[model samples]
Target: MSSDLGRAMPIERPDPLALLEQQEAQRLPWLLPLRHSRMAENPFAFFRGAAVVMASDLARQPHSGLMVQLCGDAHLLNFGFYGSPERQLLFDINDFDETHPGPFEWDLQRLAASMVLAARSLGLSEKQQSRVARRTVCAYGKAMAEFAAMSLMLMWSAQLPMKDLIDQRPSANLRSYLAKVTAAAQSHDSRQAVRKLCEPDASGTLRFRHQPPLIWRLDQLDEIWLGGLDWHTWMQESYQTYLADMSPNMQHLLSEFVCTDTAIKVVGVGSVGTHCPILLFRGKHPDDMLVLQGKGAELSVLAQYVDLPVPEHQGQRVVQGQRLLQRASDIFLGWYTNPKGQHLYVRQFHDWKASVDVGKIDADGLRDYGILCGWTLAHAHARSGDRRAIAAHIDEPEVFARGVLEQALELAELAEQDHALLLRGIASGRISST
Candidate 1:
């Protein structure tokens, strides 16, 4: 631990089931929405809007052992938005707060449960839900098999680009939508992003303005970064390593716009309590801009099973994982040890992105999207783990896909039941909340 951070932030470990019991009453409110979600059925959505019990339930769960690289909290809604470095607007896994290496099953389970949840939302018949889920798992299984067989070099440069994504399905509406999303994505880099997200102060200096409740600029943190001992070292020492790791062109470009910027809390469901900060900077030209995000890195939800070292710095796990998982990672992708010795992983915030809404998709679209996510996730996982063993284990995608969907149905039910318990716990005040 850094001398600056006197005591490490003790890792939080909560009893997921008991926490649910305590949060149950509070969750009774969103039971209905959860039920109608695409994952499972029979939830009571009486007072449908609530995040309290949901947050506590996820916060309390025991870690899963299955992360050979995993997207922490792989629920459906967590995926969405942003542009890619190529200036293409594409969709893929966006959140990585709980990312860690353990058992790969954890990521699969979370993803399946999310699908079931979305299906429930559509009020699909049990059979319909099953079909949608089956399609998704099958796609995932198939994709994993394909990924496991690739050559090392191919795996490294591999990308499920938007063209390949839209081409898999050759219909007219999708074709049109693909062109639209593609065009929009190409024009959505950080410069345009800054224009859309920033505003001028009365003094004419550019500032990010919050539109009432949704968006807010966080320049206040400048004091914390400037005056704090940890921040001083991080800005001076860590910044070099961060810049060194960027791609050549990105490095040169970032050289111009890499000035200090403010950070802000953005959005996510499972990651509500986590630190997700965005850095805003202006380059040589007023229009030259970049946005980097510093998201909190914690022990993987898979920590319970893995033989990890005593948590020296939580951010190390993430820094290595992102390096391992993505082919062309952000130039500033690195970890920082804070004054309080907190570990944080940094990346380009609002880097191009997109995700298909599994919940809103028709049964066919749901199946296709699931296959894509499975394929993409498998490629990521295979790169991080023992590819030989994983490939051997999942040689057959079609059969394994079916089994995953079946298992997901069961897991989805459990998630719903647990969610119910959480609502009760919260309503009874067994779990404290503000």
Candidate 2:
């Protein structure tokens, strides 16, 4: 019988540099060089930054026609540990900048390809890399099957605790590494973030430390362009608009805080040039401060390929996608369009959020981590997609797993070639790195 699973479709590959140029047209010019530098680091690094490139390719492929609210840029690094509203540490997809409704296997393909690239980066043999990819596919298949049989309430309540993940470490070295990472994540609260990013000024007011090209206070900009108003006044107006979207209780809680400072914070490879501003607020006491990130949101790359409704506001689309996919999300998550018509989403910054050190993980550890990532992706998809259909499509787990593994290997090879092309572009000055 013909199968929908892993069907190869014709692809008219776009010129990589031309696509890069198209994306660059939408980003801040100064930051493109930094993005290029980061992407040039290695194949895995390029994979992290080339979500649009992969999305372009995936758009041409035959899909299973199974749709889910996709974590559009799903990769190994995007899976991380963050605190739930109740202060429980849970592991899930932490980045949703490009999230939207798309073919479910698009996410699986992105994640699987990431594993292969990451494995190659660590100098793993092809056999070992294949093992990791296979394990990931199998884990996803099994998890989806489990979700297919689970009660709705149980599925909604389920979470993968950080402690359980650490305990599942395959070796003593990995266990010790995870323990340290977990401890660091536990201590990475808002206060810790404030301490790291902010310092007391001469007047005793907390101000963000100037980190040239990466982080800077708004006042440090060459011009004050907040509609001819002062920084503080503009911030207050923005806060009120953001506050309007919160619940009554949350609004009351937030009302107790006063805006102190705001700064431009450049973050992530794929999100480098977007407008990301960190807002600082002081609560009842000086020590009680909150740092919230306002990140610019734009149309998802997948939007071009799928026949979906254009979101009235991209920020709202991201916020809704995050709520649907994550078991628990940041309590303060919201969105609003700025006066300039730019869509931006707001969330508490680094409130006990941390990511595993992928560099420290050995081959066995990578395999284990892949399993967790696969299972987490499965859960997110099961929540939003028809789990029964997904489970049925993944029939004969081993065959599906092998097919995915082979596809991942092929994609990895292609990614390496693309990485080389990017490097050549940089060297030949076709792509600017300065």
Candidate 2 lDDT over 208-321, as tens digits, reads 988867896877764434556666766777777788888999998888988889987889888888878898889987677899999989888777677766467888899999
Per-model TM-score, in order, reads: 0.73, 0.95
lDDT of 1 by residue, 1-434 (tens): 23231223235634554433333332223222322231112342311112223333332334333337766556655454455455444465666655665556656656666666677766767887777666666666666666667788887667767677677664444445555655665565667667877777778866666652234344434455334544435454545555654569766767677555454454443333345556677777766777776665655544443444434566666666655765555555667754444567777665655445444456555545555666666777878776667656656766666766766776667567655655565467653333
Error of 1 at 171 (Å): 6.4
* Worst ten in a row by lDDT for model 1: 44-53
Off by over 4 Å in 2: 1-10, 224-230
Q: What's model 1's lDDT at 356?
A: 51
CA lDDT, candidate 1, residue 229: 45
Give the winner by TM-score.
2
Off by over 4 Å in 1: 1-67, 77-92, 170-179, 210-255, 258-261, 308-312, 429-434
